[model samples]
Every structure is written in C-alpha cells, then in structure tokens.
Target: MGSLDELIRDLRRFDRRKEVTNALARKVREPVPPVRKKIRKRAIEVLPSSGGFGRWVSKLSITAAVKLQGRAAGIKLKGRRKGFPDKQPKVDLRRIDQGRAAAPSWGRRGEGDWHFQTVTPGFFTETTAEADEWRKAAVSAVDEALGVIRRG
Candidate 1:
C-alpha cells in the first residue's frame, strides 16, 4: 500500500542493516588485540627482570599492620577465685606486623623464558604507623612502573 519510492527506501534500509550485521560478525570472528605480538614485545621491554628503568617501578609492595594485644591481667593477692592468679601480670606492648613487596610472575616457559616470583619479606615494624609507611612506599613503586609503561 506504500508508494514506490517508500518501498525502495525500505529495501535499502533492510540491505544496510544486513550489511552492518555481517560486517560486525566478521569483526567478532577475527583475532583480538590485532597487535598482540607488538604489545607483548613492548610489555617485555617495559617490564624487565633487573637493572632497567622499569624494573623497580613495576614492582608493587603492599604492607599491612597487625596489632597483637597481650592477654588479660589476673587479680592481685591469693585466695581470690579458683581461676584467678596470685598476682596481676604485666601486659606486653602491642606489636605491628609489616608486609613486603615483590614482582608478580607469569608462568615460566621452556627455551630461556624466565619468570619473577613474588617474595614477601617478614614483618619489620612494631607500630601501625611504620607499617603504613612501608605500604605507601610500595604503592609509589607500582605507580612509577605504570608511568613508565604509559610513556612507552
């Protein structure tokens, strides 16, 4: 019931839709990262094992503080409760636990491909403030590494 011009326009619209759909399907079927190989090489160069500008920067260190409170104090003098001790015990100072940072490693491959495993150092602080300082240093290191990658 439509005019001839309107019918032609409808057909053209359908054809355009079909074309777009086919194009999208083909694109989806293609390999992703069109430049995967290049990216990989760049990533390697930007992230090296040691003695490189990106080496220290790419490492992430996260430090956590842990508070360890001493046990409860017992009652003073004897003849108290059955569970009570003769004297009140002194409480030990709370200690802080510090975390260490290391590089994240991808799995190793045959033929000279090496990986860097993450190594966490033992706690080194007795206070939360010291632990926080270590954590901030780690974050800064990671940020520096990201900056290097972006520049590349």
Candidate 2:
C-alpha cells in the first residue's frame, strides 16, 4: 500500500537494517562450536601422539564468526608446524601428516635421537570431513534466522 520509498524506509527502521542482521548472525554462528569440538576430537583419532610431541592435536583451534556487514560468515581451523619457530621438534606435523619419517631430532624427554614412524597421510583431509555437516547446518540456520526476522 505504501510507496516504494516508504517501504524501504520502514524496512530500514525496524527490520533488515539491524534486527534481521543480528538474528542471522547468531543463527549462522550457532553451528561453529559443535563443529569445532568434533574437529578437535577427530584430530586426535586421525593424528597419532604416541611417539611424537603430542601437542599438535591439542594445538588445534577454530575461529568462526559472522561479519557485522551482514554479508558473510567463516570458519577457520588453525594448527602449527610441529617445530614452529623453525626449530626441530620431536616430529614435524607436515612429515607426520604426509606419512614420512621425521628428519631428525633429540629433544623428546626419554626418546633421544629417534625417527618417528610414518603416519598414514590424509589425516588432514579426514579429520575435518566430519564437519561437512556443519555446512548443511549453517545453510538451514540462515533460513531459521530469516524466519525469526520476519516474525519480529
């Protein structure tokens, strides 16, 4: 019934301008925590810790957020090379992830100067595969958030 300009102005005042955006942001961000936890657990199963520093799995981190611009959301998993700072760690992450023997190292408390056994490659790919469901959840969350915005 209103003019296009009036419709736009009203929409800006009580709806899409902020309420929709905030609701959508919360919705989109909801799946990230569970996904992050699943990823951390999978990392431990896929990556071995027995003969290595056992720290890389613990170092796994996830960062996720919906941008305030109301345009985007993202999830990032972070981890470090075993010998971050470029020194020699008991076993390098890249080497273990690739199913290769660690070059050489002597810092492990009781296992002086040892070669770590090759871990099966694809650990990187498989560990995060469990989170594929997260993408689906995120998509549905957008719909839920839009519905909430409309109801308001």
Candidate 3:
C-alpha cells in the first residue's frame, strides 16, 4: 500500500495540475468587446420648390442637421477659435439658412417653408453565450476544488 505521506503528495500534485488547466481554459475562453459600427444617415428631405434654390436649401439643412447631431454625440467640430484681448476664446457661429419663398398664386398663397429629418446609427453585441459559458466554467471549477478538499 502507498504511504500516507505519498498519497497526500500525489493528491496535492493532481489538484495543482487541475487548477492550472482550468485557469488556462478560462483564459482561452474569455470574451472580447465587439468593434463599433459606422453610423449612416438614412434619408433627408427639403420642402418647397425642386429648383436650384430648393436644392441649395436642402443641402444646407442636411449638413447642418448632421453636424448638430455629431456635435451632440460628442464629436469634435473642425475649426479654430477666435479670441479677444479681454475675452476667452469662443467658437465661431456656423449658420446655414433654409431659403423660403412665397408660393405662386396658382398654388398656395402663403410663404413657403422648408422641412428636414435626421438619423443616427449605433452598434451592439449580445452577451448570453459568454455569460453562460463563464457561469458553467466557474461552477465546474468550484465543484472540482470542493471535491479535492473533501477528499483530503
């Protein structure tokens, strides 16, 4: 029969090897963050005539809206600041006018106005699989450690 000291030594060696293997496996199965996706504007529109003036207004409105949204989303605006001798540096006001004109008598008799819409995109990932795997591995490791201790 094996000596008590030899048996204890063998059990300790087996437990150490199991722990190292479990740790390595856990590292290999670790989850990583997903990459961010690009946001794209879906659609844009401008009211009033479809003439050159309307086209210009539409372009301006779309540009303004996109810039505004980007700024609100924490994007840095491209420009230099202005400073007065007695005042702090300030951002220059950027403006885009949506041109409006009076409708022809043949149509409505009121002043024409412009309208537009904006959109923002985002990215995401599901963590169900990663969570499940982590839980299973953690439970298994704990159970194995407990078994080893109980046997000792």
Candidate 4:
C-alpha cells in the first residue's frame, strides 16, 4: 500500500496542474484588453468586457501541457444565454464595471451598428511576448504549493 505521504504528494501535483491551467488561460487572454480598442473604437466601452473576449478567455480550461482551450474564437464569440424568457446571448462585463443595462451608445437598441471585426495580428505578437513571464510565474506558484505540501 502507498504511504500517506505518497497520497499527499499526488494531491499536491493535481493542485499544481490546476494552478498552471489558470495561469496559462490568463496569459492567453492578456491580449484582449489592448486589442479591444484597436479592433473597434469604443470596443472597450461599447462591448461588454471588451467584446467579452477577455471574460471568455478567462474561462479557458486546460486542454494540454501549458496550454488551454476556451469559448472565445473566430470574429465572434456567442456568450451565455441570458434574459429570462428571451434567452438572448449575454455579454459578460464584470471586467469593465458595466452590465448589460449599460450598453454603449453604439450598442443601444435600434443602433444596427453591431459589426464583426478580426483581431489585429499584432495583438497576438504582443501577448505571446509575455508568455514566458506568465509561465515562469505559474511555475513559481507550483513550486510554492509544493513547498507548502513538503513542509506540512
């Protein structure tokens, strides 16, 4: 039979993996903020949570080593269904301190201004540049978690 210490070590490994997943997801989504305005004027204000890309990306799940998969994709990301009976697509805006009721002027009803635009290629370059740093931080966090396990 495995010792109690072995079980504890296994649990710590699982925790570390979860932490790494979160870190990777954060890194993947880091570009959304800056890319928002570039993608469209007032994109940060008009769209909930910078087009809801950041929030969607933040929900990314660990699919592979040091990598993640999320709902935000293509030129558009269909968000969660909202409204009691209407069941309309919801935009997550907690990141920007605004709710659906505060849609931007362009986003108001009857505006007919909602259009899709692709993210600039430069955004990917800028975000990937910092990937190493994010990874390092995640590694550090894992080390800390493991250290705590060891001490305990």
Candidate 5:
C-alpha cells in the first residue's frame, strides 16, 4: 500500500485531471470553426435613406404621417432562398462511458459544400495532418498540467 501522503497527492492529482481536461476541452472547442460563412451582403440591399418623398401624394393626406407610421406601401423584396447549415459541431468530452473527447461531424458530408467542411474536416482521425497537430497540442497541454500538479 502507498503511504498516506502519497495517496493524498494521488487524489489531488486525480481531482485536478478534470480541470485540466476541461481547460483542454475549451481550447479544442473554441477553434473548431463556425458552421458557415456569413451570407453574402450583395444578396440583400440596404438603403441609407428610408425612401425619400414619393412622387404622388394628396395634400390633405399627410405623406410625413405615412413615413412616421411605417413604409408608405409594403415593398415586397425577396431574394433567392435556400437551406443553410445552422448548427456548429462541438467538442464533447465524455467522461462517463468511453472517457474520450470527440468533435462530432454533425452529418455534413458533401462533395461540393465547402462551408460544412470548415466545422469538421475529420481532424480527429490518425491519417490526417490536423490529427497529428491535435495530438501534439493535447499532449503538450496534459504534460503542462501534470507538471503544475507535480509542482503544487
């Protein structure tokens, strides 16, 4: 059996593992990437002026009143409508079951859709360069945390 002091130190290290893991998780989550690029500004039109005076208006009926109320007439402006990805995949660290960290792809697989790839381009796999980078970062983080715990 280990000494009481050694056991206490081990317990302290175990307790701190969650904090270190969570810190690493936050780091992993923040840079995963946004779901999609912002829609093109050209698709929508914005006017600096709220539509200056209309060509025809009766003198008795106030045009200024109409402006104050809202638009003089309902101008139906429509653009090309389409579906876009809305949810950004997250880095979920499951401690209870598998005890592994993962950032799910969220079922975004398309040959032509580039935006979906931004969120999760399969960086978790061993075959990719990104995976190697992730491994280095994760290892570095855990080592740094262990060093802190040892020093403390």
Candidate 6:
C-alpha cells in the first residue's frame, strides 16, 4: 500500500530475492530431469551400445543449478546429445536420429567405407514429446512468479 514508485521498487526487489530466483530456476528446470532420464533410456534402446557413445550421448541432459543473472533467473534446456566418452564431443544425435550415422563397414579398412544402419527411428522425437506437459507447467510457474495466477 505504498506509492506506485515504491511498489515498483518492492516488486523489483522481490524479483531479485534469492528465494524468488530459486523458484524461477526451479520452474525452468522442472521439465528437464525427468525428460533427461527418459531420453537416456530411449538412447539405450535405440542407439548401439558400443564404444560408450550411446551412454555418453544419454548423459547430455544437464541441468545446472539455479543461477541469478542481472535480477533474472536462468537455466538451460540442453541435450547433446552429441558424442562419446563424455569428454570429447563426437557424433551428432540429430543426424543419427535422422539416420545419418554410419557404422564402419566390417572388414574394410578405410573411413570411406561406412554404412548407415537401418535402425528404428524417432526415438528422441517421440520420447521428447511426452514431456510437453512439463513445458506448460513451466510457463504457468513463470506466470505465478509474476503474481499472475492462471484460471482454467
């Protein structure tokens, strides 16, 4: 019940509070962990489990701890789903999902002799679709943080 300027300052201060920042981060990250696990599981199922490429690819779902940046909370929704060994970024999940990955032609001794395998497709896409609800939840969380309660 203060002046408009004071109320605006207080709102800004509230937005910058540690608890609020954490809440915002939580909202952003809420969709990630479970989706990550599902993607990992799917990776195990669809991709070959050799050279630990599939395993490392599955490990790409990283949820960093909540961070406050310039009075705003942030988190990244990421997946590399990139490569192997967890250290070196090799392989590309998108290409693989699109059937672009190639396995070395057995008994051949050159990089020129690589063949794309015909495995089941759409593992990443289908599984990721299942987490759509969490996205809506995240949006609603942001709205709530702004004191905008959703009805319906």
- TM-scores vs. true structure, each candidate: 0.20, 0.48, 0.21, 0.29, 0.27, 0.55
True lDDT of residue 124, candidate 1 = 18
- Sorted on lDDT, best first, the list reads 6, 2, 4, 3, 1, 5
Error of 4 at 85 (Å): 19
Regions of model 4 farther than 4 Å from truth: 1-9, 12-113, 121-129
Clashing pairs in 5: none
Whole-structure CA lDDT of model 6:
0.58
- Over 4 Å off, model 1: 1-19, 25-34, 50-152
User: TM-score ranking from best to worst?
Assistant: 6, 2, 4, 5, 3, 1
On a 0 to 100 scale, what is the lDDT of residue 36 in model 3?
Answer: 9
Q: What is the per-residue lDDT of model 1 for residues 1-152, given as tens digits with 9 covering 90 to 100?
A: 22323322343435343443334333332332222233233323433346341233222132122211224221111111111142212211111011222222343333344333333222112222233333343334334333333343
Per-residue error at 140 for model 4, in Å? 1.1
> Candidate 3, clashing residue pairs?
none
Per-residue lDDT of 4-37 in model 2, one digit per residue for the tens? 2332334454645566556655655667677666
lDDT of each: 0.28, 0.51, 0.29, 0.37, 0.28, 0.58
| Candidate number that wins on lDDT, 1 or 6 | 6
Better of 4 and 5 by lDDT: 4
**Candidate with the greatest TM-score versus the true structure:** 6
Best by lDDT: 6
- Give one digit per residue, the lDDT tens place, for model 5 in 72-95: 321111112212255323222111
* lDDT for residue 134 in candidate 4, whole number 0-100: 40
Query: RMSD, each candidate, Å?
Result: 27.9, 8.4, 20.3, 12.0, 24.1, 7.7
